[model samples]
Target: MTTALLLIDVQKAWDDPSWGVRSTPGAEANVARLLAGFRAAGRPVLHVRHASANPASPLHPDQPGHGFKPEAAPRPGEPVFTKSVHAAFLGTGLEDHLRAHGITGLVIAGITTHLCVSSTARLGANLGFAVTVVSDASSALSLDDGEGGRIPAETAHRVALAELRGQFAAVQTTDEVLAGL
Candidate 1:
């Protein structure tokens, strides 16, 4: 099957202190590794950047953080789909681009595993695409538990991967994905 590497929201904005502590300190390295693998294999590589609508968000277009992180930066030929929401596919024409390129499967890695990564994987699966999420190549920030408690970043990341595994996408480590590539 023809597969593509989709890196979502691996941007400088995620490094901002306001986002809280993030799990998976090695995620950016893993993402870079995956990018190298895909490039070596001559497969497609797509990027999804979050252009937050909120003016105060670091991801806002006017912010310096809107730029991609060095490890996940797109090369001249790679396609970048900018979005204003959690799901990369929403109004991004990502699906159409994939279809046009004959990409049937997607290997996804990104920042904030429980948000953009999860949303994109679910939507991709529902749209009939085979999606594999690279667990070690995605990070998540600590979150409010909605009960006066806080969910640790590690716990949140693990739970998000657990929820997507065997349902929306196949969750694998960076090593596994590299071996496959």
Candidate 2:
């Protein structure tokens, strides 16, 4: 099975100290490791960026900060999938792109463990792709209410991972995925 690595949302907006770091947990390191591996392997790396409807938001297409992080920028020949929703498959030609390249297996790795990572993995499985989620390659950001109560990002991440493992994809650590590759 030919596999492609789906590196989702390793964008500057998500890595910003002001807007993103406040909520994003352990994302920087996870993505860093994945990027390094992809580089060494010279594999296909598709960077999926989320385009927000909010004009002034950081993820706006024209925003420089909305672009991929410098460390993980797509190489000259890499494909980039831009979309408006959590799942890169929504209205995007990502699935078609994968098929065009004869990629039947998807190695998913990215930020926002409970959101985009989970969403994409589940959809990839439904779309009939062999999918595996790199456990250390994703992260969950914290959430809070007006009352100052916060939900720990790690706690939410673990719960979501448990749900994703047996259903959507295999929950393999970066080492596990790379060791066999």
Candidate 3:
């Protein structure tokens, strides 16, 4: 099966302190490892950049933070799909591109595990792609639990992976994914 590496929103915006505490401090390293593996194997490497619609957000196109982080930056021939929302597949020609490339499986990794990473994995699975989410290659920031309670970043990351584990995608660690690659 042909599998491509899909990196979602691994941008400088994620480093903004306004995001509060985040989990998986080493995620960028894992992402870099995955990128290297994909490049070495001659597999496709796709990138999704989130351009926040809100001007105040660090991810706004006008902000320097909108640029991709070095570890996840797209190389010359790699395709980059820019989106304004959480799901990489929405409003981005990502699905069409994958289809055009005859890509049947996707190995997903990147920032905000509870949001973009999870959303993309679910949508990819629903769209009939075999999706594998690299648990250690994604990070998550703490969030308000809606009742004034705070959800720790690690907890949020774990829950998100658990939710996608069986139903949406195969959730594996970076080592497992690298070994498979």
Q: Please list the C-alpha lDDT of all candidates, in the order they appear.
A: 0.95, 0.79, 0.94
TM-score for each predicted model, relative to the true structure: 0.99, 0.88, 0.98
Q: If the candidates were sorted by their lDDT against the true structure, best first, what order would they fall in?
A: 1, 3, 2
RMSD of each: 0.6, 2.4, 0.7
Per-residue lDDT for 137 in model 1? 98
Worst 10 residues of 3 by lDDT: 172-181
TM-score result, candidate 2:
0.88
Flag regions of model 1 displaced more than 4 Å. Answer: none
Compare candidates 2 and 3 on lDDT and give the better one.
3
lDDT score, candidate 2, position 113 = 77
Model 2 error, position 94 (Å): 0.4
Instruction: Spell out the clash pairs found in candidate 3.
Output: none
Per-residue CA lDDT of model 3 for 38-125, tens digit only, reads 9998999999999989999999999999999999889999999999989999999999999998999999999889999999999999
lDDT comparing candidate 2 with the true structure: 0.79
Local error of candidate 2 at 68, Å?
A: 0.7
Q: How accurate is candidate 3 locally (lDDT)?
A: 0.94
* Worst 10-residue lDDT window, candidate 1: 12-21
Error of 3 at 83 (Å): 0.3
Ranking by TM-score: 1, 3, 2
